[model samples]
Target: LWGVELDPTSTDPRIPVVLSKFLRANPGDFKAAETSLRSILVWRANFDIPTLLTSEDFPEELGENIGVIRPKDVKGRPVVYHQYSGVDHKAAFGDLDRFVRWRVQLMELSMLQCDFLHADSLLMIHDYAGVSIFSYDRYAKAASKKTISILQDNYPECLAVKLFIHIPWWGTSIYKLVSRWIPEATRKKISIVSTAETLSVLLTYIKEDDLPKIYQ
Candidate 1:
């Protein structure tokens, strides 16, 4: 899957790498791994994921600079960044369906860049410099739930880490809102960074030269 040409018998290296993710996620349950793999494949067909890679009709939220995949990190992993600073949440996510679609598309785009053969996963960074822990409204909450569910179900083992930088003192609330949907295994991969150490902590995984100007 993920646009690779592989038959059931084909020994494409990407096949094992991708399937191993499911196997690892299921933890020795081959049947569960098969089900998850089939489900994700079906999801791709229903979601028309292939078209998204070429379609220029991306959601308008993309114009708001809310999410982007930057260059690779020090380990050559895709570095995906999402910044909520100065964003008008109502305008940015007014259309829940479109916002969720964009979120999926953006995530898939980053995933496509991963080197499955070499073991690459995305390094996601969310900046909350101008946002608050209580910023999520009913609309945002609903969309977040649906979006997180889809990603967790269809894109298992896709993230290396999820870093929340530029967080305020009360940022723990963001965790409560988001952790409801995230599985315990994935939740352990998240980190809420204080404003003072945002750059320092990020530089450990990323090259400072590749970081966006905001972080610098």
Candidate 2:
């Protein structure tokens, strides 16, 4: 994997991190965990995820809008700020296949920020202010569902926590679209807040200095 050591006796702390991910994702089912690990390994190679980290094959502006933000959270974990409102969702997700690849590439970029030995997961921030029912159309929803499926199955346990902020009452449906993709265990790590309380709540996890200027 990705040049990181996986052997338990290799003296690399990342080895345990890798093993723990499988164990946590599969629980006590050693057989299922082995099966899943093999599947992810094959998926990673076929997906060419390693090259995605070095390639400039995707549009830079798209990354900004989807937000694989570089800023670390309060605990030094990588943070991703995905802005859902006031964005050109159609242009960003017009080609669902390409969009998913680009999204995965951005995710890889964020994951690289983690040392894995110390910070093995990411803090995800979702901003939904100014979003309307018509904004999150079919294309965006489809792209979201696809990306979530890929990450949950192939990546596994990379999301430490997620916060849905500045969400309007109508944005409940927006969350609902992808909520199914978040497993029950992962859902325990999420927080959803109204526009009025978003700032204070977000600041508790992400320092103001590290938070994006747009969110501030």
Candidate 3:
């Protein structure tokens, strides 16, 4: 129903405000709680998880994958990885060959999620490449069109579903580039969504109730 753009830096600022407000407003909606926690879980994998809150250090490598750094500290200074908090899916799939397969697999799953969503609770997704999730390889316009189409066909009640997509303005170019390369079916699905309306829907979900639980 809503997505809040939170600064992964200072969790104190918006997480508490938005999360607490949402929970209080929707007490019985356990799905919202779980959905919120799922997002936090991804953040924790990269950064510290403060009571289910995430502190994102983007454009950096994750600790698990970082290497080539010295073992000893230099004069008591903290050691840091060059790519400390970033998710390069390209690296995960091994090499070029595997990456392609992985992308295709992910695209298929995305299609499935779009087509066969059968839950009473709404589905909320955030991030710059929420749509780009369809075409991991490149932003093929056709792929984006297909993603949009699947979504439109499956998700008849977009405005009613508790979905929130918080895409950063900066990533728009990359998103477009990735989206443009997608097949037409996916592209058609993306065309229906207006960025501004998505933001509005997310903001509405950030009620005063959800804010309190996040701080604790």
lDDT of 1 by residue, 38-74 (tens): 8888888998877866774664555537888898988
RMSD of 3: 17.2
Q: Look at candidate 1 and give me any clashing residue pairs.
A: none
Model 2 residue 33 distance off true place after TM-score fit, in angstroms: 1.4
Residue pairs with colliding backbones in model 2 are none
What is the per-residue lDDT of model 3 for residues 1-216, given as tens digits with 9 covering 90 to 100?
122345567644434544543354346886875565565446334432232123322222223342222121212211211111244544443343333333333222222322112211223332342334433444234333444444333222321221223443544565566555444443443422245565444334343333223111
lDDT of 1: 0.82
C-alpha lDDT (0 to 100) for residue 188 of candidate 3: 43
Best model per lDDT: 1
After superposition, the stretches of candidate 3 with alpha carbons farther than 4 Å from their true spots are 1-85, 104-126, 129-164, 183-185, 191-216
TM-score of each predicted structure versus truth: 0.93, 0.92, 0.28
Candidate 2 lDDT over residue span 24-121, tens digit each: 98889999888988998888889888777776587654767667676788888988888876678777888788888888887877777888767888
Model 2: worst 10 consecutive residues (lDDT sum):
1-10
The lDDT for every candidate, in the order shown, is 0.82, 0.80, 0.35
**Each candidate: RMSD to true structure?**
1.6, 1.8, 17.2
lDDT-based ranking, best first? 1, 2, 3
